[model samples]
Target: MSYQLTHPSLQHDRRILLSITKWLLIVGVSQAVQIRLSASERKRLRKIARGHRSPVREKLRAQIVGDAARGLPNTVIAHRCGVVEDTVRKWRGRFAADRLEGLKDLPRSGRPPSFTPVQVVEVKALACQIPADADVPLARWSCPELARHVVAAGVVESISTSTLRRWLTADAIKPWQYRSWIFPRDPDFAAKAGRVLDLYAGIWEGESLGVDEYVISSDEKTSIQARCRCHPSLPPGTARMMRINHDYERGGVLAYLAAYDIEGARVFGRCEPSTGIEPFMALVEQVMTQEPYVSAKRVFWVVDNGSSHRGKKAIERLTKRFSNAVMVHTPVHASWLNQIEIYFSVVQRKVVTPNDFTDLAEVEDRLLTFENRYNATARPFRWKFTRNDLDDLLTRIDRHQAAEPALTEAA
Candidate 1:
């Protein structure tokens, strides 16, 4: 009996079978006549397979060269190794032509040296010394000035200011005045810092207030002179140059101790002839007793590591009087950690910079007015870099590994 070619499932099976058969035929023929390896290719394969070391690189070289020498084409080797065929061909050609030296990287060409290592050290030492010791005319030694000094000292043969800057950057040598910083290595540093952060973070959210004292964030502008507004006096025929004798004495310079409360969003400032512990304590008392009560059930004060602040008798006396008074001191040289410094910066920009009043009372009045305005709209500060950030950063390096080799530094 003859079978009919009309069954749908049988037709589908026949088409799939034809495709498989065609693919198998092409593979079988292609494998039969692969490319042959040249003599140069065999030498590279032998050397990489035997003498040259570095397990990872050796494995790569061996697989590419050995596969080619075994009569497989570059394309076939690349496909097997999961890389571009051109990469395999390029490696093969280079290894054959130039041997080991060709595989090594070439030195990048650039301008020659202007300063030696010894000379750079001498420059650094000179820069680090006091201006008096250097016998220089300038008050301080800036980078450019230091570069000139190096040339003048006959340390470096000849160098440009730009080249000196480049070397400094490359060497990571910073000569600018830096505040000496010291961290509290106490076991409870993390816990104490966290407590301070938590208190400030949730100051407005709950019943807690932040108390802090800010000294003059700037020096007193003592030499401010008050004079009449400058204008040419008009004659009878011309219009009048309307002017008045500006009040100079009534509004002179005033020194102030600024105390701010985080929850109340208000500042209480006291003007004194100078900033001393007595005025500071008095201001603290006024902040505690006179100001209107904020939402906080208690107040916490955050201060920095200053000598006047660390007076044991004063702190003990204040703490005894106020049941809720707690003082948190930031790590030495870490005053930026305090949020009140940020408030002081704002005061400098808005209140102090615009106009120099003729007398001290004007300075005092301006400070008080600015404090009033700030308190009316101030909001609680949000601090996010928790103790965890610092903890993680400090412990990142693995102690178990051998220390890495020091780099050969350039002048």
Candidate 2:
């Protein structure tokens, strides 16, 4: 038998058997660990196992738990996965028993809502109801009023002012600020609203031209100093501090509104000696005539609901002359929609504030300078209120009107 040498094939077979036995031993021993999980724990394990593995440690554990075949040592895995060794061991044992479903996350612990969803909805409805039978004097709602009314509805134990605020913030409700609009009872409201929407919508959809008015953005500002008190008094070569009367009743600063739109690029303002309708109309006409043939498809004006603008004859004249021109009126008591308001605020802060004017002319000059500086880079206003807003407003107003009974026949 060739000197009794061991057979090579038998040796190889023994080595293979040993390797197989080693893996079988590891698998059998690993699977023997038993960790019984309650329903909640099973759910929690499943949740932790979701999604792709991240480079981070917990993500790797999730990845391992996600797959039933992959196995890591309890201690090494726990450290790598940012979980305690006990948790890793427990999860690994349960996962072996239940497969991939064992990694679910358990539901959170918290108090149930005070009000059911249906009751919450009813509460919101009651809170939105107008205070007066008619939407007058009390146009919009205050949080305190809304909370009081909601409490009266008996939906909740009690609604606190702070509670109402939390609801508003969480639910994204803003009832305090006034919105720009009115329910035009005119049967032609839909048509008129459509027309208005068309003009603004085109500014983005197709083309747009800037529209606005210059009323003497003028307002009376009091406490303008007649003399400079900060500088030392001196002769012609010396500096002198001017003196101004502190009496506001005697005199105050009068600022004007001179506004301009330059090729949808610059907004110019001037403070005129007057803010009369005549000057306003004159400036509007100037804006209309001065515009270059500049490929302007249309001009849309965003003006406040000032009486001067609605002057029937003047409006008719302007509308008839410019077929594509559309005038949009900011709702009564809703001046925030007008971008000019923002510009005017800026002007007040930067150009006209923290100083006293000796005369209206000085004030006007400052305003004019500001306008010139701004108009150098004027741009058309991009309004966002769409047809949807108009529709909702109309529907609400219509509902209010429809719900009201016709005036009872006078006896």
Candidate 3:
């Protein structure tokens, strides 16, 4: 089917070229070998010849047929279509003998597969095994290594790295790459994490938050250092990137305590000497003294199990200072649940990255300036994961953990 071309004028030059080729062929007065074509067949062949995405060989065949149908000699067709006269003759004769069916290449038996299905399975299973278990003394498997191992094991007598790569790619198996993770180790992980998630969803103790109440995700980023470059940094230009000196003098390091009001879209922070009960309390005091929070009915603070806000003592210390405040700790090693860590990540990218500060003062100034700039545009983060998602996560982890030992024994 023909489309309404966006730029019909664009096709005018191509039309002119084809017309000129035809006209030059007609005036030469050489006897042409004619191939008759019905109107529908002629239109179909022209469409195929003009199609932008058509295969090169298929388009060439269509052009040869279309020109032959128009009574052009084999030499003219060959010259304009960029083929030898013998190439044009073959297609023209085939079209004359069998019409459109002759344009297709006849099927031929391809090379036999070098590996059978069972052998492929054996190779893949070997790939999934630890290199130490295979006694190959490698940290992971590469295509070449896998090929050699499989050949030595008689899974295949000989195999190429490319063949192994192709089979692995088709199944999306990459034995060379790995990622680090942890299974939830805390016995009360689900219950503890669920409470933090509830606060994120504006729920605590199974009730919606009140208008005067708030949720705060708080944490400390420790050991942020100020590195004074030995030389002035160079700016990026054409075909180059910004360069900074690797050698530097350490000005000092400090802890940054930050608290993000989850539903309020506000951030309160301060540079501390270090992270401890005292510095964290100072941060709590800074937030508690603010106008809305000072008068807030209840403020729930979500934090991870850091030394500053770890156990019952930290909770008792915080609540004793601010009567309206409530302390909630995320499960051990689970910083992902703390929304303040999200703000910390943003600071890591925008403020602390490259870290070419002259001194700790410059670092502190940059951080405080960024906090104000960030709050101007910050909105409440859309946190959708709930206790139900936590349940699904734990269930999946349980199934995977349960299967691991059995899988090992079976192996």
- Could you tell me every candidate's TM-score relative to the true structure? 0.43, 0.49, 0.79
Q: Candidate 2 regions off by >4 Å?
A: 1-28, 32-88, 94-104, 108-122, 130-170, 174-181, 185-259, 266-270, 277-358, 384-396, 404-411
Q: How far out, in Å, is residue 280 in model 3?
A: 0.7
The digit string of per-residue lDDT tens for model 2 on 155-190 reads 677867886777777777777775555445456556
Which has the greatest lDDT? 3
Q: Which of candidates 1 and 3 reaches a greater lDDT?
A: 3
TM-score of 3: 0.79
lDDT of 1 by residue, 149-242 (tens): 8888788867787777776777676665556545455555655556655565554234443343211111122232222223332334456553
Best by TM-score: 3
Q: For model 3, what is the C-alpha lDDT against the true structure?
A: 0.90
What's the ranking of the predictions by TM-score, best on top?
Answer: 3, 2, 1
Clashing pairs in 1: 251-358, 251-359, 252-359, 252-360, 253-359, 253-360
Between prediction 2 and prediction 3, the one with superior TM-score is 3
- Residue-level lDDT of model 3, residues 1-411, one tens digit each, is 564445576578668888999888776435444699999888888888899988989999999999888877887888999999889889988888888889989898899977799988889889888899988989999999889999898889899999899888888999999998887777889989989988777787889988999999999999999999999999999999989999999999999999999887899999987999999999999999987999999999999999878999998998999999999988888998899888999999999989899999999999999999999999988888888999899999989989999988987
